[model samples]
Target chain A: MARTLRSALLLAPSAVLIGIFLIGLVRLIASSVLFDGQIDLHHYVDIMNRPDYIAMLGRTLRTAALTTFFCLLLGYPTAYYVARYQGNRNILLLLIIFPWLVSIVVRSYGWVVILGPRGLVNGFLMWTGMADRPLKLMYNDFGVVMGLVHVLLPFMIIAILSVLMQISRNLEEASMSLGGHPFYSFRTVLLPLSLPGILTGVTLVYLMSTGAIVTPLLLGGLGDTMIGTEIFQEVMHFFDYPKAAALATVLLVTAMAVVLPLQFLERWLSKRLTDGAPS
Target chain B: MIQTPHIPIASIVETQNLARDNTPAEPILSIDHVTKRFDGATAVSSVCIDIMQGEFVTLLGPSGCGKSTLLRMIAGFETPTHGRILMRGEDMSHRPAYDREIGLVFQNLALFPHMNVFDNVAFGLRARGRTDGLKAKVQDMLALVGLDGFDDRRTGQISGGQRQRVALARSLVTQPDVLLLDEPLSALDLKLRRQLQTELKRIQQETGITFVFVTHDQEEALSMSDRIAVMNAGRVEQFGSAVDTYHRPATEFVARFVGETNLLRGQVQAASGGRVTLKLDNVNATVTVPAGDSSLGLGTDVAISIRPEHMTLGTGTDQPIAATVLSHSFSGATITYALDSAAGRLLAQVPFQPGGGHPLPAKASVSVGWADTAVTLIPGKPGHSQSDMEN
Candidate 1:
């Protein structure tokens, strides 16, 4: 049918791109399992058994989780302000998105200039006689998390804002008319209605931070190397392709393990939220 | 007494009597000189209205006439730029919506989409922290609105009419001193609108809650309100009973907005006592109508409103004006005839008899006459010339 042909044509470009990526993924999996052209599970077993790799994975997950939490804490209020602002909302939204327009690598380096030992914050503290010495602000887990949250804050804010804009102002008024205080009305009405956006922002920031490389490599200390930096060092510095591929496979599986459950929760929550709503 | 020839002063006395019979000593809610301005443009001018307890008072006007703004001020959703709102003699103008204890059923119903009917109805009770017998009270309110078993369904799962009932039940469950409805029935179909109008009136009576409803439909206001406040251009043009508003409109805008009427331009020829005889423009006829306002001096220009039903059409010699039939239309209950007369193109509604065959043919000569008591002198210059007053 013509309809079938048109749909096929529409899907061809994205399908071809995904197919190429899938072929690369298959090669990566094969390399992870192959040692000297013989099929083996040693590489994957070696990764699972290694204490350092285990620590790296744990550190990566913890950093990602912290990044997601901080992003939500900071983004929610900003998004709420922008969504409910009485003036031109576009100006506020533009400010939120301005950082995203810059390259993430450049922005991460900008954080280095600000958070360095001799940087603006330390300089201010020292100049004000608040600190006797320059405080350790970078080359640690704290630095890596700060950078990741900065890079991902806009995503979280934008996600929450889109959903907040959809909720009618009338619902809040109705709650207030029924004897709810402003804060009570927000918690009982606005917060619950915007849950889908929160979930989306949380999942997106978590997934992106888990696989982040540049920020962790630049900002973290030598012992604070995450799974992404570990995989990068294996493949590029040591030229250990098999180990790198195995680590990548581990990272993919771990990310999926976190996201799959979240995807399910998102589905169930969306069904409950929009079950009988008018289209 | 000055010889007031044909003024029906008795009807005015009857209206006052009826108002006195039902009106309570103290009004439950009073909007005293309230004015709302948004960014320098006035939405509601200095308007005052006293709503009695257990009375259904409608703020009726066209869109942008400040009826909704006035209602919002009464509901405490919007603070008035000027003036005080008194609830039981207490100044509540500066109070928040929650502290006002006023329930408002919004134009869109504003039902919580996230909550089921039971939770939605019980929300007010829970918000007020009065959890004592909350479930039973919600159930009772639902039953009052005839939504007994629909508590389990989400707001989106129900029909539009059912959602309207849910909104009503939710607001009434809080047992607020006054309930404000902002054109809640405007979304439904005509048949459903009529059914809900009756339902809303019944609920208002059963709860004995003062209702300040805002709507733009004149007929809806006329049918559902105990007293209707006809608004225009950010001001209350007239606030009175439906019969008083319809029979004796206070302004030219009220005369035209409240119902369909033929506005005939005229000038006062003779003024005596509480009546004035106005000689109509273009037509060689003089009509004596009640001088409701004492400002009518001799030779003053005025416009008189004549309801279509009041204008009688016949071939009798006593009929004052001669006209030709322009066109006609058949509604189920009445046959409306358009007559092209020397006065202007006037509309006349006649009761349709089942046995009466057909309307007068176009271009047929006819005679038009109306009782002098039926003419209401509009207290302003005629808005348009007599020829263009077809609407």
Candidate 2:
């Protein structure tokens, strides 16, 4: 009984914080449904009926998915190299996470400076006679995705590196001594073993990209508005709290719709791969 | 000292028999003066040995004694710094581990934890693209290692001994030129280790694959290997049969390391035709032994090794030395008595008959004696004192 009391006392602070968040979420849901003291679903219906809202939701999903894909494509090799590095691996890991130490808004602005219309890439291309005009790099979907991938890449690398370090180096040597070529050994032994890390990175990067507001609002043009930007505009510009709450609820549901299946896949894959294996 | 040819006794007989019909067979693998230095510290220094086909050769030593380094050099996981390694007369000095057709069962067993028994055993075959009849080959290898019908179980689901067998089967399915075992049974308990030692020997003989095993336990080496290489300080001190190594250790280090011995400092008092009488220090005794080497001459100081079991107690007829018991230890089959004698501290192992009686009480007076043949004249003076080389 004393142990239980101690545990509850230790957990009380975080529990109270979560309770406050939950109360605020309940109030948001109530406002989205209740107007003039009569409960109605018109705000949700309004969101569903607008074609531009649907298109913005589609564009948000596409941008998030593309961000996740590019993060994984660039992060896997970098994480593998860092995990296998013999000398002072922490220095490399620190370099990867250094960008994350800066504010996400500041980093997003940094990307805008490098990828702007008269930025370093366009200046180099025009100076080298490769292009006659400056490239329209920012204020587009490309800029938003580039900024999001840059900001969220450390998550993917850290997730993959943690799992890669847990794998024994002897397994690869055993495979090689059994007449396995290096690439064949990596594919058959290392890749399948690292799937859990890949899944976690993909889930984290995709979810964070979907709800992103600062990067998308700063780097995106009129055609590249995402659901987070729409939610911000509904509340900040029009003073429509009910509509913003409804859009936020829809964003939550849509994010879950994509992530729930991914979470199930992660659990199933880990179970199939590591069930009954020694820790 | 005369170095004997590195031919096992059984193989010498086979060579004599084959010499009448054709030329004698060449060694399947030869480690030619191989040396390995890591960061300017020698790990294996000028080690050479010839391993015949299908012989179970064990590199036996304590930890940090270069036995595993020599085995790794043979397995192509490590390259020798000084000498060439010849496999069937071809110098495979710089071959990569994957290119060499040698299988190593690691000290940790190194089984694929993510793979089931069947997949783990079939991994080599699948990796080498030898997919035809892969299932049957895997099953046969598993059954050979006594892991039949355990195909679906993950490596973690099985017992430790079962995992060891899976590692063995995984290495053997490809039928490599040789199998190198790096203390694979060290993780098991005493009973399971003994059981697997016999099982490993049986499998090696059944498949007729040359096995180069590395271990630190002298008893394990004696019980399992056909020939043993006793290594110390990055050098091969002695390489011979188990009986030869146990009966006649080559150096003072081997005499102390291989088994329990009571070493006594002595000087050759008289030398006559193939026999030398040695005057022992602090014991007032003179023992005559055959002068086996040219190093034994008159007035030359030497050390003699007498195994604990060779010394007899309470013999009554020839009680040459008087002593008092220090302590006694009961080890089920034998009772080892530590004696404080005029010759210095000595150990005497006596057989224990179960339900017979209690051993001699502590501090009891005793007499110890041994035959002239039981004393082995170590070739050189003792390098390290007994306490310095205890382990």
The per-residue C-alpha lDDT of model 1 at residue B170 equals 92
- Poorest 10 consecutive residues of model 1 chain A by lDDT? A270-279
Per-residue alpha-carbon lDDT of candidate 2 for residues A1-279, written as tens digits (9 for 90 to 100) = 999999999999999999999999899889899988999999889878999889999999999999999999999999999988989998998899899789988998887778887888888999999999988898999999999999999999999999999988878889988988889878778877998899889999999999999999989987769999888898999999999999998898899999999989877876765542221
For model 2, chain A alone compared with the true chain A gives a TM-score of 0.92
lDDT of 1 by residue, A211-274 (tens): 8999998888888799988888998899999889999999999988888898898878667644
Model 1 chain B — which ten-residue stretch has the worst lDDT? B1-10
Q: What digit string (tens of lDDT, one per residue) describes model 1 on residues B84-203? A: 999977899999998877898999999999888988888887788777766677888888899999978988899999999999999988778789999999989999999999999888
lDDT of 1 at B363: 98
Each prediction's whole-model lDDT (CA)? 0.85, 0.84
Please identify model 1 stretches exceeding 4 Å from their true place.
A1-23, A37-53, A85-88, A267-279, B1-23, B282-284, B293-295, B314-322, B352-358, B365-367, B383-391
Ten contiguous residues with the weakest lDDT in model 2 chain B: B1-10
Model 1 DockQ vs. reference:
0.40
Give model 2's docking category: acceptable
RMSD of 1: 8.2
